[model samples]
Target: MTTTTELRVATDGLTKRYGGRAAVDGVSLTVRAGEVYGFLGPNGAGKTTTLRMLVGLVRPTAGTATVLGRDPGDPSACARIGVLIEGPGFYPYLSGRDNLRVLCRYRGLSDAAAESALERVGLRARAHDRFRGYSLGMKQRLGVAAAMLGDPDLLILDEPTNGLDPAGVAEMRSLITDLAADGHTVLLSSHMLDEVQDTCDRVGVIVAGSLVAESTVSELRGGTTIVVRATPYPRALAVARDVAGANRVAATDTGIRVDADAGVAPRLVRALVGAGIEVFDVHSSERSLEEAFFDMTRGSDSTGDDPEVSR
Candidate 1:
């Protein structure tokens, strides 16, 4: 009997080049079982290209990857892969149910597969609605449902929430989260930090076709700036600087800011209070995933650094 490894996807030095331009350059990353993994990058950041290679829609120009412990090009492995990359094509005249039925037939899946897929995406009621009549959000949901036709072990979605409005975005987020909850391994790629931060268990950041960083959202927010409000601004500023062991301290309009971890909050409060400074409030401006992204990717062009920081 073959024992299944925990890694759902593993790629090492995965490179793809078009002409002389390197689209995906030496990206090494791993996605473990039963987690919603986020592949984040701006447009043309090679996120789509990387995903295309994984699903065997496009062959890798260089490097290697394994999906379900089999080569990506292996047809047997392809059967265990589900994709909603780009936007799915649906026959405009066919109802959603019929569209899914057609896909099921193509994949040689059963009618139960069609029904379960629609139900999973919460589109069972509208299963009979015409494909062309679907709203942008509905179209996205149907695409997801169609991808579930095979009930594959790994689901790879490229920019699944790209064009949706706020409500649609939230719906897509809910659907992705629910899939992960059902013990499905999902790999979703998007440019939206909020979507990934909300939906993913871990995120790998791509920039200029490089895997620049990979970590959980909380771990990405590693460098937090503590904001402290105390009477006697200068003295409080000195206390913050001393406590945080940081020179990147600045006086805000109402308080002082010091670059440090959230752990420094208590020490900051105690020091100010001990120094007879009236401590009013202390909070960490807590570096957001987006903020950390820019900070890490800043001057990436000049530095050409592929720093992988994980916890």
Candidate 2:
């Protein structure tokens, strides 16, 4: 549903070299408007460096990048992009509300902006709590609230859920969803594969400073598969192959896996039942993003990555 013109972030052959080694090498990716785009990679995979380039904190050594239709770091573009890279840094002694108010003054924004941001991130109830006293989740939410100060069109968050507990992560995920629903574009970078798989509409996987894959979670995982658990294993196998085609049917540790759609489940069950095989259960399955990610970047782990390059 997103057109080329709606792209909020686009890079072509973007590169950044630290001394002789390239932290990010010839990377090209896109972030569409109003979508939760995940920039996924492992630690030292150059995710942070790439984000720094996107937000103008660091310059790219080669190639080009456009943020919000303007060159990265352009004042006009920067005004429209809110960033929360590396995490929030507020005066520990200041109240959460006061911290935002300070940022408001520094940015020449009104105190009203601070109040609105607090309410947006559900921090208004405890807005008066000291920064050092707030829970980890609350601190992260306050960080997001700081970024939301101007109601910018794009939010560039780097591992917002880095050190949170389960409940904290859930809260951050909900906040992201709400931001996108309100027509904001979010470019979320994280090394956490499963979290990215759950939260992102589309993801670009970076490995060893190079982009290996970019696509929707389901697309990257490939097609649907029908998994059937049945008794009389041999009979069930034969029946499944006959019904779903031998090439598509493969035996798994627990059951038979058919590389077919859910529509084939009924026919498979029926065939097994008629063949005197007791069907225990039948369901559709898909390859997980984690499996696909490891498949694409298999050997990179053991080889290790450059320590000089940041995540």
Candidate 3:
């Protein structure tokens, strides 16, 4: 299938400041249409600030952003975009459907569109329930439904799976994927590296309010690190020590722990055999997305170097 290359969103030197402190420093990103773009960062890493800027909840300090080829802060631009920030805003006494109706009124959507939106998020059965009685996951679903109400071309969700259980998280992930399959561009801001790695086609990692890395998950993975079990620890350790790109080589009870660069497993195995060691098993230690996230932002902390404190 041929994929279209539409620039759904773009930022140039986007920045935000609070009380003389830079919450989100100069950053640039692009989310292409029909793509699920993951924005990843740790707590206080400015992911929220950036999203707020994109949706015009907070104005940028010194940069510009565009959504769907127009200024994101413009009222017309808002019509083409849907955002779910923080939590869903709903009247406690209003029924779920009624809440959506109010939002539709604000956006000039018809009653029929409201009903369809509710059905899209699987809340049609509970549409009559008051917002106060809904569970967290239900509220989240309703939030997404509200965002989808306008048939928006772009959706920006911030921490969409904040307080959900495992099953709810799975459902949300699947829902986002389905939305992308339906041709809506999605910009998902999340702190969960594994979730982003699983759901996103492309990712932009931010550390201390700056963009550190941008790439596909496979590219970020770079290579595999494999663990091998072998006899004769001393000889194995010697061989591993001499292997180039070996980050760590240590003696273990059953084998030697080796951290080699990507694509070095086969050569490592052969080296062990050449050293007269009996190799029992070879297993690849795939680095999780969390590990990769850490590796990318390992030393970006703003605090001055303190030998006593560990990151």
Model-by-model lDDT, in order? 0.81, 0.87, 0.81
Write down the TM-score of every candidate. Answer: 0.87, 0.90, 0.83
Q: Where is model 3 more than 4 Å wrong at Cα? A: 1-5, 237-276, 297-311
RMSD of each: 5.0, 2.4, 5.2
Q: Write the per-residue lDDT of candidate 1 for residues 1-311, one digit (tens) a residue.
A: 21349999999999987677777899998998989999977656778788888987777779999998999868898788788888778999999999999989998889899999888777888989999998877888888888777778889987787668887788789988887888889999877887777788899988888889888888986767778888888888888778766567888786788877787788778888999999888887777778877887776552222221110
Clashes of 3: 0
Clashes per candidate (backbone, < 3 Å): 0, 1, 0
16 Cα displacement, candidate 2 (Å): 1.2
Q: Which wins on TM-score, candidate 1 or candidate 2?
A: 2
Best by lDDT: 2
**Per-residue lDDT of 1-311 in model 3, one digit per residue for the tens?**
22223788888899887767777788988888899999987667787778887887788889988888787678888888889987888999999999999999988889998899887777899999999999988898889888888898999998888777888788788889989999999998887778898899999998777888888887776665567777776667777778744457766664666666657778888888988899888776667778888888887773322111111
| Model 3's TM-score against the true structure | 0.83
Q: Tell me the deviation in Å of residue 156 in model 3.
A: 0.3
Clashing pairs for model 1 are none
Worst 10 residues of 2 by lDDT: 301-310
Which structure is stronger by lDDT: 1 or 3?
A: 1
Task: Name the regions of candidate 1 deviating beyond 4 angstroms.
Answer: 1-4, 246-254, 259-263, 298-311
